[model samples]
Target chain A: MTERMQNAADAGPGPHYLALRDHLAGEIAQGALAVGARLPSERQLQLGSGAARGTVREALFQLEAEGLIYRRDRSGWYVSPPPVVYDPTRWAGFMAYVAEQGRVPTTETLGKQSVAASAADAAVFGCAIGTPLFALDRRRAIDGRPVLVERILVDPVIAPDLLDEGLDGSLTAVLTGRYGVRVVRNHVEMRPCALIKDVARALGVASGTPGLLVVRRSFDAGDRIIEYDHEYWRHDAIRVLVEVRTRD
Target chain B: MTERMQNAADAGPGPHYLALRDHLAGEIAQGALAVGARLPSERQLQLGSGAARGTVREALFQLEAEGLIYRRDRSGWYVSPPPVVYDPTRWAGFMAYVAEQGRVPTTETLGKQSVAASAADAAVFGCAIGTPLFALDRRRAIDGRPVLVERILVDPVIAPDLLDEGLDGSLTAVLTGRYGVRVVRNHVEMRPCALIKDVARALGVASGTPGLLVVRRSFDAGDRIIEYDHEYWRHDAIRVLVEVRTRD
Candidate 1:
């Protein structure tokens, strides 16, 4: 049981279990549970709170099912870190997603390559079949939690040198600093989809976990689609708030 | 497996299993799955596919895992129809989501009344805490498959007759038809969320299943926010599509 929960035990029926559960919930709400904190084991909760083992186990089970906690087999239960926040409206990319949400981010650039696109890839990037495209893939994490697998596709005619630049900081920075392209508008489409095999494995979820699919086409100052890309994220990891405004 | 699977079994391995899975997927893709078609049993598929019971079983398992098929304890597996098409962008209310996808719909209103608002409920309707509000709750379906649980909050002054009229077709239709408060614009906020106990039970899924959180505010020709509502859609049950244009 968390310390906060133990404090609540005296006034409640099933005080022991209720106290522990409440305590853990409060800590999580207060952001004090700290990502990856080792939670009390099932047996420890029973002994500390003087509850039946079944009650303690049930409480742990509920938290795990709610995505509030995770277990690593013999490692016991640990608090799940907060989800990554992403805004499709901004062309700021995933690094911004973490920083804007007030979390530190660690980025690993998987690759930056110039490749001829496959038919499916061409269809998405809105380029001719077999056109050269820039593929930049990155894995973004916040508070040590894997959040999104993002792959950006850039049209080579617009930003030929983009493939050579480091993508650790920002895509927008490269477009502006290196290629003199300013992203002015973006068209985004989002849907709920199953995580493909690679994404499931990378995100440490079971295969076929539902995921969010975000496809965005970003425009340059010239009103050209300089970048058209697809990104996937773990569902239930974050909530996307889209405020659609109409002309007055 | 359905009757179609049985007939497909007469075909060779080159086509039987692929054909079986495709046929079912196509039915779903084309919206011809029609909600509650009885799926054949594993034993039945074995007899029909001419493939091993295992092959048919694998296909069934894949579809079930995909939420395209579901089973009742005593009843057989059945097709889960596509989610009723709903969009947060349209001011036409719930019906626009379905009708836009070229599907006909029917509604049975659970209850409708003018309510003196509770603080929480009033905030959703954009009304004062004690102002009269038109509150509606509905059970909506597509092709006989239950797809959405819709709750709407509207200003009572503009929709005084909404409670008197049954809410079967469309909420926006009622507002436009009776009050002349036609929907001219909508502001939508969308997020990925997990179904808690109450929403899960209503949507026929495990509580942990992911959902689409769509909160929308509809505006009339006068640019006033007329109604505020939210909807929860089963992720596996629907696909929302948008045509993305290159920023030209």
Candidate 2:
């Protein structure tokens, strides 16, 4: 429990677990406990709070449920990193922001292929039902922690031999430089989701963990759909940031 | 199981459950099953597919886990609503957008009080410790289904008697009309979250259901923080949209 929480417990009537939970939450918000910092073990917290072991455990579980802390297998609990800010309105790619924040960013191409679009993909791509599209699946990480899985579908006609070119690094840059496809606008949507078996395995989190499902449909100067992207981000690893200004 | 799914099961090499799941998913995506439309009961699906009852149950569970459907108390499964588009960049209110979408919107004031800011709240509001702020707790609905719980913190100094002004209706309208506080810009952050116990009770969902936690810091004409609002939205109810123009 934080000192403030302890004091509140003495002055007020909430339970010990409540006080401890608030205290830890306060510590996290105040930056006294930095992101990705390994928290003291449950035994240590119990000793510090002088609370029962069960109370400490419950408090830790509460923090995890709140998405404030997370645990890796066999490794003890760690304070979650503050969510990285993503502004969908900007044309910037993942590399720009992650590097700007002084964190190492990397992308691993998991799979790449040329596939025939199904009826649904055709509708999304505004092409015939059997048009061939390039599909690129990649895992993105910041500071060696896997945070996002990106599944991108591109118009192969616009960027022929796109799959022959190396698929690593910033795909956005590749789209502009190699493919000559200029992204003019994007329509994005955000949804809360659970990590199903495949995505959960790729992200190294539990199957049912909460996540953010972001779908982006990008258009070129011709207003043609250039890319349809699905990004599954670990809930704790990123924050969606946008500024709204009144249009004059 | 959908007819397409059954057909795919006959033609493809995937498992029975996969075909069924995709069929249902396709139906939802294609708008064959409109948002909030209940799916066929397990018995109906089973009888149609000639699948065992357990297999039918498994497919429904898969859809729910994928965030495609949800069940209400004794009401059976309903197709998750298409997420309402939310553009935080605009100076609009919940009532405006919900109504524009042809859905009825209502706000219920749950609690209101003037409280001294905690250290964290103080920092967000850019005020000294112990500043008096009016906190408004409200639940918002679209078409009579609760979709959001808003916890708003405002500087009472700017809108004294705001509570006495009655805490219902569009808060943005109230700020402009009553207090003359012109909301100039808003910085919003979205995070995937699981509903905690209190919020779960308020939204009538299971405690661990996924949700979107949106934190908006509103600045007035003077560039001072006017409101720090946290809106918890049901995962299926809203999709955030933003348009970012290059500063240049």
Candidate 3:
């Protein structure tokens, strides 16, 4: 056993888990374990630290709670990557921003359908409750890890053939190219929420996992609401940055 | 028993909890149980719903995960209030914003101390490492429930004698009133994180609870970093809104 593991074993049961947690945290902090690297199996961790299986699991749980690591169902734990910086004020598309940050971005179209607008949707769109709305579900990933799931709702009158176009790419580009609609402004609201069942399944996290919900209403030059988007992001996957100057 | 409880009883063990969860969720949605209202005890819920104690607890757990309810240690659960809207681009202070939302706001100064700047702090403040800084810790509440804990770090060179003033009120007012330091701009970064032990304790939540961490660096007209703040908010307490317009 290593000296740190020996020390953890000497510390007895109560503090043993903390020692292990600190040891692994130190490894990640020192870049000994790079981001997205899979951790050893629980049995291996237990054996390596001379700690009980429960103690090893507790240590791993602490690290997960600290946002340093995460577990995939049935899959092993892995170090978490640094959060991607998102600036909604920039009006950049997802592909543009992620690439600018030097990260690989991918989008998968999950499904699409035509749905009647609900009362809340009608209020936002200022249309009849049963107005036809095209709903597109897409999952976005960074470095092969799924990070967010978005449901984009577009009024059918605004983009009649939107469903026929390719959607495994940036919707911003498609809106500008096909519909000649340039998004001029957006009103965004974000809150911490829990992942619903469908979103959790798509993101490969357990239902009820904490998440960040961002709702954006995009408007065209004439102040027409062009698209409404609901984005559910993994709690650790993104950091929101905003710079505000005092109004003159 | 009410018809809803009878329906839950007939739904079998697996779906029984879901029925109860939906019932309570409906109550919360319709405002039958107003925000911040205490929930019935677990035993009471079990007796009322005619379900197993585990089933009642499971339903409550689901609601908590949905951000519709929350627990307060030994205290019983309470209905979660609507999130207070926060617009960082506005130059309003905490008291101003919360009251504008029609919610009561209160602040309590927890403690204060002088600390030397670390490498990261020095980088942000453009000061030498080990420079003296004033650190003020405060907890803010809405409707009698603590929601956030903030640590404000001030450069003593810019706002000397700041520690000697009353901090139970908005620091923005103190900065303008006493120090003649008007914050002209701010850079804010926010992310969902797990609450550390001390912060969780102060907010009366369990350690490692999901939280929203917001870090703001406020600057003066001369572009001097005046105050750097770290705010840890309950995951369900606030919503962030930002309206971005296309640059001309």
Candidate 4:
């Protein structure tokens, strides 16, 4: 072997804190440090790295900066979960995909109310202003982490009793099975949005935290608009996948 | 009219700061506050709203928190541009879309280098590790505001003289015209990501600022993988638009 190769081999993991960082990164990449798994304490890392406490802290800070690990207020550092892949226009429910990936998904209804559609809403839905609409507010979580908060608007005529239907599960399933309105198409738009006001409060994050704002309009088989949804997702919690085929 | 409706109508706007917030929000919604246009100063808003300076500042803070307006350090507040709609898979160029929408689009080549494909990259590209790939770093802007930073990897054999040619302008156009490789399909994935280190530095944003991370793999008509790109977009600058249609 060349002299440089032999020297690198002898040095093995490199500088103190960097070596520790590399070790932790390797573990994360290899799934040894699984998503949502708590990391060792700073003291433990210090011991493992055989570096000074300050050096260990710096390495941890670097990892946090890289988005490989995150810190919660009461909780310590933990391996950041791999982002959940979402297909906004797909007919399948969020629960199905989360479960398919072996992650536990849960939905909770925050509130429900009947409201008069505003002028803007009327324009989008092609209905008169003040048309009665059912608004369902929900918080969705994966593996005990609150990830998304959604406000869904539905045409009351299509699902007259939607407010009382116990919106704790997949609204899509409920719309198909009970209301007989199946979503066959969707127009979806997503942008980065700051989590503010009630949305940040719902997701338990600070106001001004970055979030993905997803707006979707779902159409029934008859081409009637059935639902309008605004979703705010934690920036660190999800990924969206889209496949586009152009030529034959 | 009901007594409550009459009271609201008589009140006109609302409390001092809230009234000011509504007025500004209305202006933004109605496009009176044009994209990239400067917002009125705090002193001007105080004059307009007839509120105290602190109240005016509070209203401005609210608007900034809501992503309707952004401050550029010393440059004062600008009406946050309405998001540019993006379709990651469309094979259309960003320059084309921006120009069509009457916005100026420009690209700057930051740097370029050759990289040896790693094992993971080899698996994704179905190539051997250590194969040469050209890496191009670029920054794209709309209306003179930097919006996206991209790292693009291309197989050297396909576009051998790529580095010799300037890396500015439309990459898709270059590939089609120079290499005779037309993109037929793409696999796209996006997630909320924080702009950090070099990315944040390049975009001139603070570290940990929320952004969109988009990864795409483009394929030619023969299903040959041609390009892999990682893009970081300012969250407030772009929105992804996607349409999905399914049969009954």
In order, the Cα lDDT scores of the candidates are: 0.64, 0.78, 0.82, 0.77
Q: Record all residue pairs in model 3 with backbone atoms less than 3 Å apart, i.e. clashing.
A: none
Docking class of 1: incorrect
Ranking according to lDDT, highest score first: 3, 2, 4, 1
Candidate 3 chain A — worst ten consecutive residues by lDDT sum?
A: A1-10
Per-residue lDDT tens digits for candidate 3, residues B60-152, read 976786678998778999999887899877888889999998999999998787876755678888888777788888899998889999888
- Candidate 2 structure quality by residue, lDDT tens digits, A117-181: 76767788878866777888889998899998878889888888788878778887888898788
TM-score for all models, in order of appearance: 0.66, 0.89, 0.84, 0.85
Residue pairs with backbone overlap in model 4: none
**Candidate 1 lDDT by residue in tens digits, B1-248:** 11222123222243345566766766765767666788767787777777787667656655664567765545777886655544333334456656776776657665665556655555555666667666676666666655656667787678766778867876776677787876666666665555544556666766656666666777776777787776667766665433333344
Better of 2 and 4 by lDDT: 2
Expressed as tens digits, the lDDT of each residue in B1-248 for candidate 2 is: 12222223233345677667778888887899988898998889998888888777767766876678888877789997656788876777888988887888899998787767776787787788677788888899887889988788898888888898766798888888988888788888888887755677788887777788899998976888888888888887887776543344
Q: In candidate 4, what are the lDDT values of residues B28-143, reduced to their tens digit?
A: 88998897789888788778778999888867766765567877766788888767888765657789998887889999998787866756677877888777778788899988
Mark the regions of model 2 whose C-alpha exceeds 4 Å error after superposition.
A1-15, A26-34, A40-58, B1-13, B26-35, B40-58, B244-248
Candidate 4 residue runs with Cα over 4 Å from true position: A1-23, A41-67, A128-130, B1-20, B42-62, B127-131
- What is the DockQ for all candidates, taken in turn? 0.19, 0.45, 0.37, 0.41
> What is the TM-score, restricted to chain A, for candidate 3?
0.88
lDDT, candidate 3, A182-224, per-residue tens: 8889999988776645677888987666678889999998899
Give the residue spans of candidate 3 off by over 4 A.
A1-26, A40-63, B1-26, B39-63, B74-76, B127-131
Cα error, residue B124 of model 4, in Å, equals 2.6
Could you tell which candidate, 1 or 3, scores higher by lDDT? 3
The DockQ leader among the candidates is 2
